[model samples]
Target: MRELIKEAIVDLKRNDGFIYVTAEGKKIDLHEAAARGIAVTPVNPKDQVIKKLESAGLHLTDNKFVADLNELISVLNGGGSSKSAGKRRSFSDDEKSKILEEWQKVEAAGKKTKAAFAREIGVGYQTFINWLRG
Candidate 1:
């Protein structure tokens, strides 16, 4: 196995509330990168809470960082569910056929790209592509 590197640099200029840094051309959360054995630089001296949490092997989710740990744990464990959480919107076969038929009219009009058409109709771009494939 390849030895994991233990150090990474934070682009302080790119700081956008969440601690994120570039690794191998992709932007990743600093805490997540740290879990993969990468250490981030310029740790804030006054941020003892983060340090304590890290030391305890606890990482906060982007949505609920300021929430109580127990609440966060409950959310993570699926006890406290959000409306959109883990649910995929599925289209019925008749809905799919109607959507594809509408797409044909849109395509014949030649005014929008596939992605733009998907957005205009409120369907996900990937989902629209899948409909086309069928």
Candidate 2:
């Protein structure tokens, strides 16, 4: 597991990352990072909060440290989306492709069938079909 982490850190393709530096000043290792639930996340580092921290000479140790501060801010603002919060649900890549394919087939038919689309989702099949038309 430790070896895998070192490989990941060595093979890191971006400057962005979550790193783990041993308290003993040893080389930052990836296994410790994985244990800490690390990943390469994208966000503006020099945003307002980052700027404030940097300006105050409060140096951050790693991405987790920065994310922890972001989470605190989201909680203060009525529990909004934080660094740890999962993003909203939406169609997956496959689902998006399926939707486009279905749409094309329907358009080519020239006569759309008001059938049960959301049958698997909605409570009653008929009700869901009615919704699709509207």
Candidate 3:
């Protein structure tokens, strides 16, 4: 049964969805496998880490484990605090004016729309629009 579960997990990972065939050539979906007590679930990295820790006899409620888990979760969630996540880049008025001026030249060339020009220059379309408004 454990081997069957592992085989199912491998099959699911190899494919986009869960599909398995038994030794007797019986095709089964994930729900059917679950009903038969195969117990297949989607692979989650966080859950896998926790399971590994538990299997290694580490208590999830321990202070050190909890702290480490929190840190790991933060990193998985795109870094922890706002400071570590970094700040939004600030552009000076002069820089904005220069970019807008360049945009005007591109606009005159008629090769690209404002949004396309903004993308080509690596600026957000809405940010470029805001610069134009100013």
Q: TM-score of each candidate?
A: 0.36, 0.20, 0.35
What is residue 64's positional error in candidate 2, in angstroms?
19
What's the TM for model 3? 0.35
Please provide, for model 1 over 1-134, each residue's C-alpha lDDT reduced to its tens digit, 9 standing for 90 to 100. 01111122223234554444344434466777778986554334224334444555545433454355666567788795464467676789998899899889888999789999888877889889988998
Query: Which of 2 and 3 is the better model by lDDT?
Result: 3
Output the TM-score of candidate 1: 0.36
- Candidate 2 lands at a TM-score of 0.20
How accurate locally, in lDDT, is each candidate? 0.62, 0.49, 0.67
- Best TM-score goes to which candidate? 1
Q: Model 2, 118: alpha-carbon shift in Å? A: 10
lDDT of 3 by residue, 1-134 (tens): 45544643565465544345455545556667778876444544334445545666655758887776677788799776543355555788888889888888888889899888888877788998988888
Best by lDDT: 3
Candidate 3: residue 90 lDDT (0-100): 75
Candidate 2 at 61: error in angstroms?
Answer: 29
Q: What tens digits encode model 2's per-residue C-alpha lDDT throughout 7-48?
A: 444535336543344544333446655677554333332342
* Candidate 2 local lDDT, residue 18: 37
